[model samples]
Target: MTTPADVHGVREPGLPGRLLTVERDALVPLLRGRAEEDFTLPVAACPGWSVRDVLAHCSSAFTRVLEGRFEQGVFSPACNDRDIAERAEWSNQRVVDELERGMTEAGPVIAKAGGVLDILALGEWVHAGDVREAFGEPGAYAGAGLPSALSLMAYVTCRKGHLSLHADLDDADEPLRLGDISGRRPPARYIGDGPTLVRLYAGRPVDGASYELAGAEAGELNIFDE
Candidate 1:
């Protein structure tokens, strides 16, 4: 099993705490001052989900993590959908308040989840991006959470397959690689900004022109979309 330290290359203590701090700071401010109509806006990254739905899902996830109620699977889109649906009647401000309270209470539990913190942080960052994009606001993708998000992407790719590939991101300090260890090298590689790379890994769309690919086959890398 990969530990949080192993998954994120954590060289210092309190990395999880720092990440939670970043998530809180980035998300809470975005929720403030949002109008009722704003909650109905569609989040491009999460098709069929309104901005309010995204908040409900995020808030539920944080609460679940705190309560030790995670689903049993690699990904749980169904459970996510259920989470949002159950909170359908919640006012936008109520959902935001729940999210804030859950995150505040989840810090210690999340920090103790071994390597799972990466995935948790990734989800928060991605949904935060969704919320920001829906509001026509710029995201804080370049913040303290970027490195951990990148690491989680690499880990997810590795788990999905063993096709060798490399990633070059404008904001990343070092290039990321996967499937190189199995002696099966594929020619195609990804080149783009860190946020775009993370979005792609999370099965979110990136404008085709925003990134470039080189090498064997692009379809081989789509496993993360599943």
Candidate 2:
């Protein structure tokens, strides 16, 4: 049965693009407002990556999509590192400029790929949260685009054939079901807010997150780290 959240529902062709556009409205302005030194802050969610590096990687990834540059292992760590390295000499403004452009333009390209690249938009939004948290901002991982991101996440997790889990989030109107939806595996359980659920799936540090789980380890929820 397809719930309003899209569990067992059809893939939304415009959802990824909409997510990107929504995130850009929120994130690009925030990035543009920060001082030069703020970009140097390390994102704990992505160790060894400064805010600048995250932005660089995001823009470059979008550029790849726009330019149709998907080679083998395109988004591997090595490829991401190479992308960041290519931007090392660019000014901070230049990087942000490219990021703004990417966020604005990558949607159509992603939409054209059908569902193959939908996860990229969700990942980009989460990285935006990582940046927000590094800046000590409240509501780091939750925002206007969260509902859409969560919907997309459920689809991605289910498609990945991971463990099934049912999330009872305090902040959401209804439970979010993720991972293998086939009846062969009973869904695991999670009780928490939406952002913490995102933390689990993204493999971000969640030491202080207040959440409950049964039938599946927290690590098993990770889609990004896989």
Candidate 3:
């Protein structure tokens, strides 16, 4: 449980840089203060995973990227679960150390991935929120990462779904289009904040009234579920 006062030094450029900086400056500090028992608390947003398990998963993902091992699917629950299982023997501090190292080492690799980095950032921010939620803390739904994370999420989810839909994020200035770009037209649109959209994508329950769905069925195009 130590502050990363020396975490900032060489900065990677672009969104990857921002994401890593946020992870180091914001997310890392949050975890540093927690007691050992806190890590065992269940994260409501991520079923079957404890707070430590979520960090282990995130650490493993970053480490894999640093090792140039990338998952093929949009979401790999099995792979993620396996990662957490494999690291089960490690102390909580060891997991955090790995995360910090991986973030530093994987920056160049993430930068080279182009648009794929957005999906990665989305995963990171969402998991950070999961940790916060598990500890009964308010999440950074409106944080610096939200706009880019939501945009990347929208792009990936849109690409995966068969239906075309438009999304207007209240916190964002632009509208997000989902589904096939070549399709004749979209049948529905979504109007919501970044938090609602992220929660829905993560398969967490959201207040029904938080967002609006028009002209199509909602919850049909979850990127995380795929």
Candidate 4:
């Protein structure tokens, strides 16, 4: 794995920018390294996939994006078993090699496209958060990447048929308030602890891990992928 840059890549649009580079250099290696493990540990949020499975899925996702194989808006069934299994035979180096080549190849193609920068920006930011969340590092994306990641995730999840939820949170433990606005309110008001909240919305139960949803009812909202 290449050494991480002192400052993560340029958070710009299109390819060859700082953000994508940081994503390639820092995030991919972290993900690939973990993929080589047995992950006997439980990834409660993912239901079935072990840590390795999540990595494999992510690798395929990056591959798709880099190969110009994406749908217009958002995907209904966000991901399926096919994505998970594709990486099953992959080693860390293999995944990294594929990602490096894909991103490099897609660089020019993205540069010529309209609003491609936004796409690249949003993709890396969101996936970075995904790897962070899957590994239980909820605060990993707590930098300049947070706002874009949160906004894009909320928008995409909504587009994919999930409710536009913004949970009210305060200093209290086990707090679970669902809405779209960010600020003070009734039962509680959410602090800007974004990544974990995003995970909760994605149907990944961060409860007792990164968050606590007091009195939260199951299926209160359909938090599944479209």
Candidate achieving the largest TM-score: 2
True-vs-predicted CA distance for residue 69, candidate 2, Å: 0.3
User: Looking at model 4, which ten-residue stretch has the lowest summed lDDT?
Assistant: 1-10
lDDT of 1 at 146: 73
Model 2 spans with C-alpha error above 4 angstroms = 1-4
Over 128-159, each residue of candidate 2 has an lDDT whose tens digit, in order, gives 99999999989888888888888998888777
In model 2, residue pairs whose N, Cα or C atoms come closer than 3 Å (at least 3 residues apart or on different chains), thus clashing, are: none
Top-down TM-score ranking: 2, 3, 1, 4
lDDT of 1 at 125: 69
lDDT of each: 0.67, 0.87, 0.69, 0.48
TM-score for each model: 0.78, 0.95, 0.80, 0.53
User: Candidate 1's residue-wise lDDT over 107-191, tens digit each?
Assistant: 6776576655545655676778778878888643555567765665565455445466677766666677754345566435888
Error of 4 at 32 (Å): 5.8
What number of backbone clashes does candidate 1 have, counting pairs of residues 3 or more apart or in separate chains?
7
Arranged by lDDT with the best first, the candidates are 2, 3, 1, 4
- Candidate closer to the true structure by TM-score (higher is better), 1 or 4: 1
Write down the TM-score for model 2: 0.95
- Candidate 4 lDDT for residue 176: 34
lDDT of 4 by residue, 49-69 (tens): 665555555556556656666
